[model samples]
Target chain A: MNLLEIDTKKYIPKILEAVIETWGEEYRYILVEKANKIKNINYIDERGILHYHRFLENCIQKYLSLKFLEEIGVDTSQDDKNLGLPLDSNTKEQMNQYFGNRCIFSPDFWKDAKGIFAFDKEVIEDFRKTSVEEGQIEFLNPLRGNSEITISNYEQFKQTKEYSKLLKQIHHYLDIYKKLDHEMKKYNKKIQKYSDYVDSEDKRKERILDLKRCELYQEIESELPESLRKYLDLKYQTLEQKLRFLFPELDEKSYIEFFSKKDEDNLETETCNVYALRLCYLRRVGIHNNLNIYDNSKEKYEECLKQPGTQEFIPSFELVDKITRTREKKYEEGIKEFIFTSQTFLENFGQMDNLEETKEYVYNLILNRTKVANIPLADEKNNYPAIFFPIRPSYNGILDLAYIHEFIHALLYFSLYDNRWGSGFDICDDDPALLNPYRLNKRKYERLNETITDIYAVKVKNILHKKGIYLFEPKELVNEDNSAWNNTSLIVRKMLNPFLEKFHHEVILSLVTANYSILLDKVGSENFEELNDCINKVDYLIDCGLNLENPEHKPELIIEYKKEMSRLEKIYHNMDNRIQVVTEAHK
Target chain B: MDIRRIIFIKKSPFRMEYLFLLQLNGNENMIRFTGLESRTDKESINSKVVNDTIVTNFLEHFFRIVSNWNDTYINKNTLDATTWNIVIEYKNGKQKEYQGVDSYPINFDSLERLIDKTIKEIGGD
Candidate 1:
């Protein structure tokens, strides 16, 4: 039966029942909610129909495919039936032959990563110990034990669940090893190619140097004796080796100028262009290796952590308004400058033939930029391939941080690592209490990029201050009317200010190459817990201070901040823990 | 008593379009608000019965925050910006409407809550 043609109203119930049986109530709830949402939409509309079709096509199909592929060891790519295409008799026979008498192993254990060992040390050791010549070693399942101790036999092994689980691990490990090997080979080839290019470049430079030397000799030929000039030509093959061939009567300034001109010619702006071209190649191929590693890490996180959600969050009105205004002001003042800067940036960095086309492309960006909450944005729709910011945030006192912060985001995107500083898991998904004491839904860890950018901005601000350009003064207390909650904002800002003031330069310097995920992971999970604890504790202190009846209590809290250095010490120590360490223990 | 005055501005970086739907009880006049300074009489596009429960819930939510609404919330640098300013007149001649971003009073979280509830009760567009 055609999957799309199946009446969803009739089949959804059956699918929900199966999902509930296998994955439990949570999965069923999610599935039902999704299904009902789609069913309500008028599918007569083309877009509506497409959405409905996609929902049915992708929903539960991945799991079902994995099950089928595992049961029949036959390659699905070779069979039309497996691909949901019209069946052929020869392929059908091949499929039957493949399935017949063969063990239909439980693929879910491997595919879903439900198996006990995820690259377990003991399992790996056992596998390594056994050879094809020595025969297979007896392996025990971590979840289950052998009631009757059994040795390895291909047919007999299929009867035990452990065998299939082991096979799954083997398959996974083999795939990873293969991928790693392929990458290593590719890197070797790149290194070799680079070396060859460098060698040819050096040879070319030698030829150029010889030609320049001959030209220089001719320029000063009249100043030299005929015998001396002939002897000078025979003395040197390369210009750089010696300078004794120069005429004593020739002006030293002229000789120096000539050599400097040659250097200037060699180090043209085109040198940067050559490097940029190399960077483009490295970004496509070499950077892809890093991306794979990043993907693997992300997959591991997905397996371990809950899928982040923002359903519980209602965005803060005050914060949203401020952010909106910040962006709006940026667009108002920065649009013209942004265009000029973008044109210059593209001409310098981007390889292009037509200047007019580049301007037109940029002009379209200005015209087509998306607006959200009165803030001009270049989000999903009308998104340019390159980092094209038509509007930049205007620099206010601390708002300059937004300018530098956004610029960094653009820089990171084009960067080889594609260091996504602005992109992260929805902070609203996390518990409100885990972040800043003032704002309930502030995302500190997930918004690591913003923090880093803020740190960088502070560093830049300090340098500018030293040069007599005072951007803005750091306030000890928050402006009551400006914030949603006055006291909370004041306390939190004061608490964070010291760290930003003291460690700004050092922290920014350290994080030049590190991406958002790397920075967070390296910072250690303990620091995050400590941060959460500190925020909670500070909140407690602030609440105590805010008691209207107890006038002395507020004074006491301020005194405590000055006197009680213990909390600050712990927090500072926590902040110091950005270095990565090997510590997690395996069971 | 019907929708007395309806003004909405859909502004993006690319384009800005304004729509106003106004109705009078006896005269039976309809006008489409084009710009801040311009209006066109779109006589064919007259008011319909917007007495549905979902619409009522939206109106109620808007009225709750009417007092807090800012008179002039102008922003020139926003992209994909949407604002709706709706005014409804009752039989007693009392009028209430919301004025906020994205065609709803987003400043008041209650509007979103109400909308979500409405969607759950009766499926949304």
Candidate 2:
């Protein structure tokens, strides 16, 4: 098949038209209305500021303006610099006087219309030289109304369901917008390749038309509602404004160029993830919480961080964004609850031997990637017993299927043997040592423990489907081998005779957990009767098994048990083969 | 009442820099930060003052220390000055040892004074 040789520019407008159409007319109207609202707000606010010049004219503000003016000694009329950001002269002067001999350059500062200032390039260079901190400008007072005090109307407005729902919708659209932006960047390079080409006049016309139609940014904008559009712009501006003032000489072009110089332009590569993206782009990754590890075991994770985006691809991200707790006077004591609950969980349930060590560990809390991402994935690292949760972090359903079945195996491991031992056998292993011997120790109530877990996992799938989360359930199995046939074949399979006899005896001693159809009301009769008989009949066999513990080296209970377990192994092997024959015939 | 800034320095082994921060208490509640990776090849500077000039003296002195140390560590190869950057964290009133660099604008003394002034101006918190 021949690939189309058409330039990428040609497909731009058509895709954009389809995009705008999907968003519907409401989106376009929202933008237009928002533009008008912004125009009106700026005009009204400007008039209000002019009218409110009385406040800044007062002695205190006037004193600041005067002192600041005197310190800088730069008149407003002077425009020697083509592009110098407004600076805060007083702060610069104080810093300069303090660190004079060690100064990198003369501190220059300017404030914009909102009274936010940027230091001179020289001042910033000095700042960088002295310290590597993202220089902050904490206002002694609030710019808007007191951020601490709640506004009555605004407080009430937030309580409305519509407001809450809109916030959720805004987040959803933001997700879509991020995906679109990431995908469109790939096409930009392809379109630029034809810049020096000797294209015909018709081709040039087509290319220009394509460029107009393909405006990716506009389509993303149209998807947002009026209020949300304004909100996003406000947030974008807040970050941009803060960075510009903080860095002083960071013009948008220079900022973009700085990122462009990087191999992956990782500094400028914005991701849909707000916390990760903002921290990464603005050179404040540490502020998002340290995700670095110092352990030898986690060395693989360290190498991945150096590459552009290894963390995002790796399924289990070891993130550290757990909530913090505070002794506060607010509604939900903030991170305070998070801190307390995590600490409490660590103290009460954690597998810690020393109190001091546990406390220290609890203090340095980190969030699991799956939890932080709010992916349906539950963490099983601590090996904590848990009920079935429907989904996991990624959409990949394989682990969910595998683990869901394994968890039931976990229940058996816990019940049959003590849990003080490390984990059970890896169920995926092909070794016959584990599989051959599993049948002899089975309780008559439910001999096929592994199969039982599978059956329950299927039941869980059905239960979840009722809640709208669909999971594939395997069909019910019907073993064709009858008890009489097993009795007759037991003599023929002489090599597995001892193992088979042991299994049959155990089964006879064990009471059944389930009846032929269903045993909903006979729980006591079915489960207890079977278990009691097994204990009653396997008295000497259990003694021999338990004695294996102390024979040579109190060779751990599991190691000792393995020797005796091989007897049952032969019996289980015969059963597997016979059952396999029956199941194969049905298939 | 005082406000102090902390910067965590991972010396020697990993040599990766991280800043574990916290506010320090005044009057002798010192958080002993032991177990820093390395203790070799370090130069220490110490100073004290009574008057307000202490701020200027502290900054100037630390700047000199860093300048001297930067030359010693990065440029000079005769001696191993791998521990180039020095943290000037304020703990209690007393600076640690010759190892502690006097850099930050407000040490315990100045920070306490600043706090007192602020309290008095705020009408006694």
Please, what is the TM-score per model? 0.24, 0.17
Candidate 2 chain A lowest-lDDT run of ten = A319-328
Clashing pairs in 1: A330-A394, A370-B79, A371-B79, A371-B80, A376-B78, A376-B79, B12-B80, B20-B33, B82-B102
Docking class of 2: incorrect
Q: What is the TM-score of chain B alone in each candidate?
A: 0.39, 0.24
Model 2 gets an lDDT of: 0.27
Largest TM-score belongs to which candidate? Answer: 1
lDDT of each: 0.34, 0.27
Count the clashes in each prediction.
Answer: 9, 20
Tens-place lDDT digits, model 2, residues A1-587:
00112121232233223322432343444323222211000001111122112111121222333233344442523321211111234544433332221212211222221111112233345444223111212110132234432333444545778546644543453344234334333433333322223133225433432332233223333532344345346555653443332222211111112222221332223211122222232232221134422111123324435666433422111111000001011112222233334322333324333355433332222111010000011232222222212122111112223333433333222111222211121122223443323332222222223223333334443344334442221121111111111111111123223422434323211212112222212222333233323322233233234333345644454453454345344434544565566677789
* Winning candidate number (lDDT): 1
Docking class of 1: incorrect
DockQ of 1: 0.04
Give the per-residue lDDT digits (tens) of candidate 1, residues B5-123.
43433322121233434333444444333322111112123234333443434433333333234554432222222344545554445554445432332233233333334433432
In model 2, which regions exceed 4 Å deviation?
A: A1-410, A415-452, A459-587, B1-125
lDDT of 2 at A72: 44
